[model samples]
Target: MKTKHHILTYALLALSISASAQYGSQKKADNLFNKFAFADATKIYHHLIEKNFNADFATRQLADSYAYMRNPDSATVYYKKAVQQDNVPIDYYYNYAQALRGIKEYKQSRLWLKRFKEAGGLIKKDRYLKDNDFLNSIFNAKHHYFLAPVNFNSKYSDFGAFEKDGTIYFASSRNLGTLKKHVYGWNHEPFLDLYTTAKRTDSIVNHKSKIKGDINSVYHDGPLTISKDGKTMYFSRNDFNKNVLGKDNQGVTHLNIYKATLVDGKWTNVEALGFNSNSYSNGHPALNNDDSRLYFTSDKPGGFGGSDIYYVDIKADGTFGTPQNLGNIINTNKNEMFPFINSENALFFSSDGHAGLGMLDIFATVTDDNNNIKSIINLGVPVNSSKDDFSFFMNKDGLSGFFASNRAGGIGGDDIYAYNRIPQLKIEGSITDATTNAPVPNAVVTLLDSNDNKIADLLTDENGHFEINIDRNTNYKLITQKDNYIDNSRTVSTKGIESSVTSIKANFVLNPVAKKEVPISELYPIYFDFNKYNIRSESTAELDRIVDLMVNKYPYMVIKIESHTDSRGSFAYNDKLSKERAKATYNYLVANGVNASRITEFNGYGERKLANGCDGTKNCTEAQHQLNRRTQFIVVKME
Candidate 1:
């Protein structure tokens, strides 16, 4: 039987090897993939993968093909499969993470990125894994921006919005149908073209139409920057001349910057800038306020990573200087593109290298007098999301702006989003004694929203003052607490406060707790067993209540503990035991939080102050004897 089983196993193993060999050769798939024919390459890879022939490599290649083709949904499946196989490459982990993020699987993407980092030999692990305050600000910050998609978005990718003079100019891949549209192999979408629409109102934009003149070319064009004077325009376009596409040594056509002059109400004199390159992409032009500096993104030699922001001086003679990289402080080993400068001299750009919420997040960097980066701030959400967010543009007021995002629930592949900042509300208050109207320093003042969630807590200064910023159109509760005083609370609302500096005064008056004299009989009694001085757990509740009353409610009150015992033992023995019991009660209160000095005295009177006839030789019930063996508190003094 054993020999027959071994023969069957051998035959099965051979059959499996023969079946795996039936899958087609790997060379065929590589040939089509190298030619950028990803659609056809994936078919052969899928067939080989079904037969489990070179499954790991086939899965990774299939994922890479769909990823290069900009189909993250399809790529995610293969990438997931590739990652499950043993000894997968490190790059496969990163690609899987990016693919997961493209589909809004944020938590899963982070897991893969963590795995990618742990695989060792990563050059930018520290840069990518560092904790970022800007990334955290997205979750803890108050909702200040309201974002919504614009009306002109189409089914294709539409982004890179810039508003100039009453007209909104942006880039889109929507085919106009008048000309033979060229589809980009990357996403299989029509080439990007510049379109313009009039800003009908602050929130609404009119129907978009193709931009006039030679600006809209047969190939990719747009993401333009207009000079302050509105007479000059600088735009990005593919390296195309007279319907002929230019290619570099790697056969990749790069983007170029072109400048045009407005002649007789029409954009004319269009010419490629001197910095235009055929080897590397340089596009997304942005001009400074005075037009003295032109900022753009490039993948040129010596960049930190995929794409970096670079600027060239537009000299007095209108000639361009050599492009200067923004340095490693702003650029990283990953891509950073879509540079925009605001009136404040702050540069806003999108980067995937920085520690972020997952994918490309928008960041703002400001430079000091020496042109060194002072600080980099992430724009955070809802201006940014796990998906790609870039091309930020704002008006002079800074209260509103437009940007681009490929996050879910958008109107197109990448939609233009408008945001408006909501005004902030301020709350300030004073904490004072109710009877004397004196400032109560060191009092805790806390603010909570309508859901009873604590918003902020601050201690009152010497002047009994506290201040905090709050959100508008919300209800809140202000609570004040202090030692030796009753806690006070007030409900306040900023629902109707519309002004930018609306300050609400919420003064708190806490009443001091009065001293009270109570016999230990009224308060829960501390009883002792025969000949015992140890404190009991059942008596702790009443003892702690007195501690709280003395330490917190009546800080100036002094307490006197008195102890008594039954007459069963000798007079001298009972007296000593009563005193020990009194000392035990006093020590417990002091140890629990009551100040030692507040305990004015502790004394015992054994059998001398018996409450009933059970004293000495009298017959008594257990309850009657227990009542005589009790500890009591007396109000000695109140400062």
Candidate 2:
């Protein structure tokens, strides 16, 4: 949790070889890789891996080579192995995820992307949007709530639900007692006023009545907090004082927190909080469990962002002390409103700036002993939606609660909802091929706890799907494996889940051990001058390529070399010249490190093999005759 601020900051080889003793060192492999000579790099990597010399690094480099060569299928195979080793770095998770995506393993890709995000990956916008585990992690919460709109919601905005002393008190835009329709311009409805009704588990709260006092002002008010003793109340109201509206220089009416005392059973003596100002807004007042401090939202100048949460000491003389901003951890550069601290000392608030489903999602805080925030966990799913969900009020039991939302199917602009939290204990997903997108039926999926202790193992059905119920609020790792496929190990946790999601998706994408067509190297025949048996300067470069191939690129590759001469020379002379040319070619390769045994055959063919039918009888151009003096390399055997 201390790392939350930093969280978003963000193949190949095959073939056996002859004489493993001749294998290159890690330095040689790295040099080839640096030069983008992936084919050459792959060979050295394979040899290093075979000898168990820093095999983990070799495997990762090999996978990267395949990736650079645009072979994701092959890259996936090696990456699967590299990632399993504990010594590898976090970026491997991203690379493996991409390879999985390249092979159409989206489900598996999401899993690895999530791993990357949790491991403090360097964040790219596209990847983060594609897989936000922070949001997904909410689905793993133990209890999912069944939400239903409270029956008393009106067509106008009705929200800020709270309960005390067997009565439900909330704010509503409903016409207060049929006084002439006075619509607040913000939402084109009646001015918000405090309303109350008897608390009931069923049926409508139709017996609603407006709170009577000097408290119900003609301007906006309500969304109030009541003390445990029920004598005093703190509520938000527009800066309408003494029957006059106070505005800032811009003629904007800012809200203020007003205190009202219940004297002789009827509320009176309404007074504005000391920090209330005409230049800025301060509203949404709440009290901590002990009431020593008052928590409220304010757009004051000294805050972290838009409307920050602040607390002021409630002095014994009824005068407030200096207001302290909640700091940047819980406040963002957007509106943070409706601050509520349940009896458990857990502070819940609504914000649009944090990582959430959409506008104004409610988030709960986890704090250390000093009240410093550790993590601000979003209340996901039913408690939150792609719309405004806020004013979360948790009951004493912590399982039954009321909140408000403007989500689809709500009765009004913002509808209060009642819910009971229930258990959600299963994981669901399917198995499929990373490259093929085909189902991997019969693949085994093993579930393990945070300690790597096995909890259960299950096999996928014909559709490659499986589901297993497990204990809640626990960390688990999923490992899937099948013959001839690379295994996938993914970690997940059930935390910050406060809504109705019965299961978390844990899909497995199995990447096959890819076998591809032999990589072809383009070959151009090296040329020689007429009657020349010595290796040409240009021909040496091509010969050197052949050496690298046999020694590093293809260890088991076997080749037969044949050299030819032009018709300009006598048959006997040409035959001797061709023989010398072939010998020279063979020696160049062997001297440059090609295993001598890989040279299957080396022979000379004289004028009998003239490229054009010149035969010394017809007049031939020098260019045409030059072509006949050349060497050919044939693949005698390859694995």
The CA lDDT at 140 in model 2 is: 43
Error of 1 at 562 (Å): 46
lDDT of each candidate versus the true structure: 0.74, 0.73
Task: State the TM-score for model 1.
Answer: 0.49
Off by over 4 Å in 2: 1-143, 176-179, 200-208, 423-639
Q: What lDDT score is found at residue 500 in candidate 2?
A: 60
Residue-level error in angstroms, candidate 1, position 164:
1.0
Per-residue lDDT tens digits of candidate 1, residues 1-639? 012111111100001433313222455676555433456678888887786655567788899887766678989998988888655657788789778877988888888878877886243443334433334335654566677547777778777788888888888888655556687766677878887888623332322377777787767887888999999999888887667788889786778888988887677788889888788777889987689999988878898867788899999999989899988878898777788887655678887888778677788764433545644657777887878777888776555678887788986777788877654457888988988999987787777777765554556767787766665777999888776776678899987776555478999898775545433344466888878888888888889888887877777877668899987889878888999999999989988988887775687888788878886566789888988888988765556
RMSD (Cα, Å) for all candidates, in order, is 23.3, 22.1
